[model samples]
Target: ERPNNSRFSSCSVGNISAVLDAVRDGRKRDCLKEDAGAFCGNKIVEVGEECDCG
Candidate 1:
């Protein structure tokens, strides 16, 4: 986990499974599987914690 960094954390994942699910669930607009978590900066895929609530 990224532990939630104020400067925008990331959940970098080698697998594209999560990305596919996001797209199907409408949580994500669109992206390239080859890009991995490089699609968006605010994406949860890159920000594993995204400034953890805790």
Candidate 2:
């Protein structure tokens, strides 16, 4: 379950599920690319990423 905070308050279960499904199905691959110096904070938790607060 998501925390009851303003950051995730607007995020619905359906929306999060859809995103997770897309990631699992490789549909979000194109959007997961990161530059040489960019790793986290893009909002999409890619492989090896621990967390993304931004």
Candidate 3:
């Protein structure tokens, strides 16, 4: 479960899911995942990424 950060304090469940999905896919959108939580960093095929939620 994600902490109630100010960034997502006002987001709905669906919205949060969408953000998580984008991060999981290593996309550069949604909350600037690449900036801090870039486990995959657009390299989805690479292993060990697991998740990215920044």
Can you tell me which runs of candidate 3 are displaced by over 4 Å? 1-11, 29-54
Full-model lDDT for every candidate: 0.55, 0.71, 0.59
Q: Residue 6 deviation, candidate 1, in Å?
A: 37
State TM-scores per candidate. Answer: 0.31, 0.37, 0.32
Candidate with maximal lDDT: 2
Residues 3-45 of candidate 2 have per-residue lDDT tens digits of 7554543458678778889988988866455677546776767
> Where is the poorest 10-residue window by lDDT in model 3?
37-46
Tens-digit lDDT string for candidate 3 (1-54): 346544544457778788789887887455753555435546454446565433
All predictions: root-mean-square deviation over Cα? 12.2, 8.9, 11.6
| Alpha carbon lDDT at 17, candidate 3 | 83
Write the candidate numbers in order of decreasing TM-score.
2, 3, 1
Candidates 1 and 3, the one with greater lDDT: 3
Q: After superposition, which runs of candidate 2 have C-alpha atoms over 4 Å from their true positions?
A: 1-3, 6-11, 30-54
